[model samples]
Target: MMKIGIVGATGFVGNRATEVFLAQGHEVRPVVRSASSADRLTIKNLDYQIASAFDQSQLADAFKGCDVVIHSILGSPGLIRGSVEPTYKAAQKAGVRRIIYLSSMIVHRSAPAIGTTEASPLVEKQQFPAHPAKIYAERKLLKLREKGSVEVVIFRPGIVFGPRSRWVSDLASQLSQGTAYFINEGQGICNSVYIDNLIHGIQLGISTPSADGEAFFVGDRERVTWFDFYRPFAEAFGVDPAQIPSLPIPEFHHSRKRELISAVTNSQFVQKFLASVPEDFKQNLKNIVPKRNKSSVAVIPQVEEVKQVEHKPTPVVNEMMAELQQSQYKLPFDKAERILGYEPIVSFDEGCRLSIDWLSQLKQFETILKK
Candidate 1:
């Protein structure tokens, strides 16, 4: 049995990875922050170690005996330097044979270019929170090939959706107010990677010798539209897909202006400057421009009647979203298929059926948690 060490082993993706490795009769060890985190795990044939990825000593210790270390921790951009870099250092020190990093699709789509591929440029602007962090992490890991013996392989996945995904976890509650809108008026494509399918890709990456020092995107073979993806969840949430209103896709000018203002306002210097602006002047500007509420644009429009949401348009986020329902951001995984023999094992319909079953049970568990 292969000794596999998983960082962030209890999280959504990590939990599934843990199950996959364990069911294969591999000896699984979870690197968790607390001893109690192991209690959340229902599986047997596993052990645990208390160590944060930030602690190189403990991380090294955790990776000591494992044949391979899978770094699957999902955290803020801060962790790129904090944990990701350190974990790589630790794995090297521990003499781990291979490292599989869980990277996102944003590395290729710096600004949502059409037809994303592994060769797509790393996002130049670092627009989103994870974009810069992931690019930085990938650079550091790839640079390791020249310096170390660890096999560094990175696999980028699209927006992962399952029952545990926030998309459907509490969607029933989120849409209970009879307010729902089709995001971007159903213009966006849902680049959804089923959780199981993603795991399958990871397995191929792990075992494939040619995958070392390379990057690949793993996703479903067929493209699924956002409307079809949303409709299933809507039905599960008891909302008629037909009745949901379309969310407004902001014009480029408005979106750009809002993004610039937001980026500027987030800085202390700009905030201080804006803090001195007269309230009346700000109000007059608001009256003239009539800013679009971000919340309304983000969620489905609140039925036939539209109310403004109060948040700013996240342009970087929207860029990641596909502009064309069918063809936008069609991520190509030809490299994965060629190098690793990877293709989606779960079809969209089967994946959705499995997810709905899990969601139904999740609702019951959430009720228990509430009580």
Candidate 2:
């Protein structure tokens, strides 16, 4: 039943690896780049393909006749180093047999040392600026898998979190806009990995045949931290990881507006400065910026009681939330359980009870307590 082909099929790990490779029956296709990102794949009659993940002939015409193509592309580090050698030369011009690439135990920077793994020696100087673009897209797909043509497996995974994760709906939208935090006291080591245990190590890197050109790491068979990964989203928002507050781990500067948006996002001048802006002059520069102060001195329509401010993140979200709360260790997935016989069948208390039951089935705590 193998025919899988998931480029970046609407993200958050290629839309949960196209619903766990079409509920393990296989023959899922998702390659998306448009038609509204394949209309956010909630899965239904999918044989999807649109392409443009840095286009190698539109990803070899969306990886035709695939037998495996999971690049799992996410973006920017100039679209993950311009879509890793045009997705391995479009999975060797569509004759793909193996390509599972996801990669990111943050190329070993968000704290390692205390015996790292996956043959340690990565961190080419990082403060998690996307860890040297996932170590230049895993040394450009292990040097295009040393040119033995296709077949490359490379699942790094860690801190992938669960339930339509931006690490659990951006920490349940920063605990409903109180702008959540914790750098040191949350006590590091959250090398998490429950997005169905990273699609169960991408189905053991698609039935492990000596896991092809190997490079595992996968995560979360415990030793969890960062307050045991924010204690079930702070007990699903009653909030109290000791009144969440720490911050000492930061040290980044040099921002000529982040070096002019990282030199206009590795330029074509940020697409001609967003196509020479207009849309009502970008909605009149968002109504001339002052978020609240049209003061000609007006009276109050009083009933004040909504406070939870202390918010302090930006400096690139506090160096990626204090570099994943300064990890310090726990990234061992025992070489993905001795070469792809992987494990982690979900349990960090049952992946926070299915990530707080997918945030109460998407009411997302009643839409973040009605903002």
RMSD of each: 10.5, 19.7
Q: Pick the candidate with the highest TM-score.
A: 1
Tens-place lDDT digits, model 2, residues 133-188: 87888888878878747888888887887777888887877876667778778888
Each candidate structure's TM-score, on Cα atoms with residue i matched to residue i, is 0.76, 0.32
In model 2, which residue pairs have backbone atoms overlapping below 3 Å?
none
lDDT on C-alpha atoms for all candidate structures: 0.72, 0.77
Report the lDDT tens digits of candidate 1 across residue range 1-371. Answer: 78889998877888888888888988888888665666666575467887866678889999989888888877555555357667888988998889999988777653257766788678757556567778888888888667888889998887787757765564444455444456655546667789999989888888898889999888887777677776776776666777776655555434788767655544434533453455567778989997777544444655776666555322232433433333366677889989999989988888877777776676453332211
lDDT of 2: 0.77
- lDDT score, residue 54, model 1? 68
Model 2, residue 73: C-alpha shift (Å): 17
Q: TM-score for model 1?
A: 0.76
